[model samples]
Target: MTSKVHLPYFDHLLELLKDQNQTAIAAFGRHVHWGYWEDPSSADGSIPDFANAAEQLSRRVCDAAKITDGLKILDCGCGFGGTIASLNERFSNLEMVGVNIDERQLERARSQVHPLNQNSISFVCADACNLPFEDNSFDVVLAVECIFHFPSRETFFKEARRVLKPGGYLAICDFVPLKFSLPFTHLIGKFLTTSVHNTYGTIKSNFSLSTYRQLAQKTGFITRIEEDITRNTLPTYPLVRKLFRENGAAETEKITAGAELVSKLGITRYLILSFEAIDP
Candidate 1:
């Protein structure tokens, strides 16, 4: 578990997210991960219900993690703590802790998430590579669209395993390349909604799904469920494309479009992977 993120892009991202940007925040209604569109028909619409779509995506991820009423969960790279907030409403008497390296996001998330949800809901400013909690502390560790932003996805995996109880789950939706190639691997990052359009941003990992599954296997976890929900989430790219253009990200707009085309051509694999940490 060595860090892969360094320098300008990660630094640039910190500054960009220090304060709430109206354009970016609008896409999430506070939850800013790439949304899941439950309605396949909405995938190609000129105007998709992004708020609804975003919530659906979170719920989908939540469902995969099997979030229960009383379980303790950690949302790694939890931005604005929106997922926790949503979960709080549905799952009562639960302890929800969201950890992120960004202070601004923590500040906003604290504002949005009430301290009392029949159980405490809190935010912590901590790195994903090294969590601030004791080992085996949580029932589940969730990363929705944010694992790729980690300094090392593998490190986060190891850390999540340490923090999670033996049967606890790690649920995530991450970008995976169809096949690893130097050219396509480099190009994939540009199309993502994670990075701000033209700025030098964090380098994203484009590991294939199999590579990740193998990593999970090596990490002492079993892949309980791994579904390619790519088609279900296709509405994200077009909306992101238009959002970039409207927000004056000319370069990112093209990249977003390019990413969309390849996705349609069946190259990009956005997966919902849930693994349960098991002791050997």
Candidate 2:
């Protein structure tokens, strides 16, 4: 990430999140990523469920990260410990830590901890840009659609690098615009969108795929896998549209539709990038 920072921090949203832990921005309470639907279009006329598809995207991230037994993982900006629960169920001998900026969300995440893995999975309230862990501590750091909310994604990149053991991986799931327009396209997207999730309130989360790749390289990491899963995630718009309507936000329909349309046209992308740590 270049030092010519263009975006602002999300400090103001922290003030608004005191009691919004149970608030479900997406259809599910646990997930917030653009869900991965095998068929974005409802050609078969099957019932669409948001949480189910969101789990698919989580699995995709886990697969790309090659999560396995005996590996320690960090879920940075982990909304409600969904990744922890998912991975804990799949792998037996795994140790996990989940961190969220908000204490309220961290409380909920801590509650999700299983009795069996209570000794293994732990949640901490901390800033992602400044993780509260030692260097070379974890085998992997997974940030699912939450980096954009951080004050400085570059700082978080450095922190992830610092905490990861050599040969460890960083997996990120985020929305990447087609063009690399800073402070402009992202600014407009916030106005058009509905809920004003943590990052959109400050426009801190505004980088395209190309920009992220460049930043990773600049931060001393190797991009091992970059997948554009727009097709798999496009189906999430309808779910978000319903959420906006159910909350009496009638004006967000157009904005949600616009996002979906732009994504289909390749002007926006839902991407999963896996980077491996190496000597810089």
Clash pairs (backbone) in predicted model 1: none
- Give lDDT tens digits, candidate 1, residues 1-280: 2123332333433344555655555664467766677667845544447766778888888888988889999998887888998898887888889998777667778877884569678898889999989998999999988887688888889999999999889999886777645366565544554553334346465678888888899887999878887787788887877766775667667766766776677777778889999985
Counting clashing residue pairs in each candidate, in order, gives 0, 0
Per-residue lDDT, model 1, residue 47, is 40
CA lDDT scores, all candidates in order = 0.76, 0.73
Model 2, CA-based lDDT: 0.73
- Model 1 scores a TM of 0.85
Q: Quote the lDDT for 245 in model 1.
A: 74
